[model samples]
Target: MSSDPRIRLSGVEHTFEGRSGRVQALDRIDLTIEPGEFVSVVGASGCGKTTLLRLIAGFVHASTGTVEVDGECGVVFQRPSLYPWLSVAGNVEFGLKMRRVPRKERRETARRYLDLVGLGEFADAAPYELSGGMQQRCQIARVLATEPPTVLMDEPFGALDALTRENLQAELRRIAKERTVLFVTHSVEEAVLLSTRVLVMSPRPGKIVLDLPIETDPAQDLDTLRTSPAVLAATEKVRDHVQRRTPLRQA
Candidate 1:
């Protein structure tokens, strides 16, 4: 893997032309994600959490400041954007195909990621055949098959049921063990559970309000982690910071 910072944003600010006027979505954003760090971004709706993720993913360019990424980047959105015509294996190999990888290697690479995400048995199945959580899992496998050094996630589990969300969180904790991840989510507990560092953002023209380092045992099972006193206390603390900035309706 490369030695450079996986992601770096310096004095970054983004503005878009709105119906009323130019609206700034992010302001003076400065962040650096080292290789192998899991960073979670939390904010109220309209606070530019998605915008930040998109900026790092290179979907939208920042109006000001430099955003640098040292290696390949992949994104998994809240909604799975799978190809219905393709089978599970095909979907996972799509990026490799785009990169002109040979068919034999593509199939092998796809199988590895599918199995990593616990969907090896569903290789030949259609995307529609899987549940919402399972479909999202396939999306993750597709991104991972590309062997990206950085993964940007826009609340990939936001739409799942509570149980499925928890299960996938555990799966993600395992999959991103070595890569750099920038995750945006509304759930405080989810952020606390999966992140090495958690960032809280302001209401509008979003800026980092708090950047907290989380220290927890990753070896612990999900059930144990959820019930641990330290985890609960950290969850509450992060929740309090968010509640103070986010509107009650959003909270």
Candidate 2:
């Protein structure tokens, strides 16, 4: 990883004004993401992981402090979010088109990334014609075609079945190897599988309680790593932190 920070959050907070009153979603978030590093955020539901992603993507304003991303970013959401009518190549070229990339260069770049994700053959097919996993591959290719220095993924594989999700996770690991990746996920194993560092957040007024480093080769196969003791140990540590931070309900 490069020494330079690609994304930095300093005392960041997010709050919503609800009818019930003020709801604090995140509090005092201080983080730095180095270039070409992969980081995952794991926490209980409604703990503001998605909100953090949005803040980084500039979709939502931070309630306090700074959320800064120094490079261009491409985002992949939980859903494929492709244009159903467009062909796979067209979908991948969408961002480039918006940026006013020349037609021939856009096509070449889209095709290159589609091939990278093993979707070159599907270039002429509509997104609806592909399987769920394939659609996500297309989505990833679309994001990569833009050649962003950073990628922000919000539960991109969360909707897939276990087998498919695992496959995509492997693919994501490969794609994120040279880019700064900030992923939001609830799955402990997912965090273990992809992250170089995992940040665990406390629920409701979420704040980072632990930032655990994961020492493993990103080139390892996901399925093989699934049963590895090191991966299991890291997962257990994250799970324990989450369970410990969860508050018990009053009777």
Candidate 3:
């Protein structure tokens, strides 16, 4: 495997031109994400978290500086953008089919990923038939089916219920174990739990203000890890950065 960073941004800035005027989304951002790292970004609303993900995903161009990704990357957005008309299996296979993989090969690959996401039994079901969490799992399975080197997620689980969100977070950790991930979320705990490192972005014209590493062991049970001192401290540090609050000093 190559040792190069899977994603790199150098002095990157992005601005949106609107009827009112130009609005800057990102300002002079420099970031490097190495291969096989799970990095989560958090910030207040309109901090350009989504914009940064889009720039790396190539959905938009940076106004200045450079955005470089080592290879093809898959994206999972806030909504599960599945084809309602297609069966779960077909939705997963869609990307592979576009690449012209043989029908049987793509079908097998789709089934394999669906099984990975715990949706193997729902292969024939329409996307609408599944619950919200299942739909998101299908969306993830679709991305994994393509075998991309990097995955970019923009608040992918933000809409789900509390329990479902946590469940999906665990599933995501397993599913993305070996892949390079750039995840954006508003949940500080979620970021701390799932990321190898968490980055806090300043408000609009966003700049990364804090880059905090998570030292909790992934092997521990979720409950144990969640309550661990390391996890709590890391979460607090990220929360403080996002809220722009200083830690209390003790005598």
- TM-score per candidate: 0.95, 0.94, 0.96
All predictions: root-mean-square deviation over Cα? 3.2, 3.5, 3.1
List of clashing residue pairs for candidate 1: none
The most accurate candidate by TM-score is 3
Tens digits of per-residue lDDT, candidate 2, 1-251, equal 44779999999999999899999999888899899889999989988899999999999999999988887899999999999889999999999999999999999999999988999999999888999999999999999999899999999988889888877887788877789999999899999889999988888888888888898866678878889899999999889887766532211
> In candidate 1, which residue ranges exceed 4 Å CA deviation?
246-251
For candidate 2, the per-residue lDDT at 87 reads 97
Clashes of 2: 0
Residues 51-165, candidate 3: write the lDDT tens digits. Answer: 9999999989999999999999999999999998899999999999899999999999999999998999999999999999999999999999999999999999999999999
The local lDDT score (0 to 100) that residue 183 gets in candidate 3 is 97
**All candidates' lDDT scores?**
0.91, 0.89, 0.91
- The 10 consecutive residues of candidate 2 with the worst lDDT sum are 242-251
Q: RMSD (Cα, Å) of candidate 2?
A: 3.5
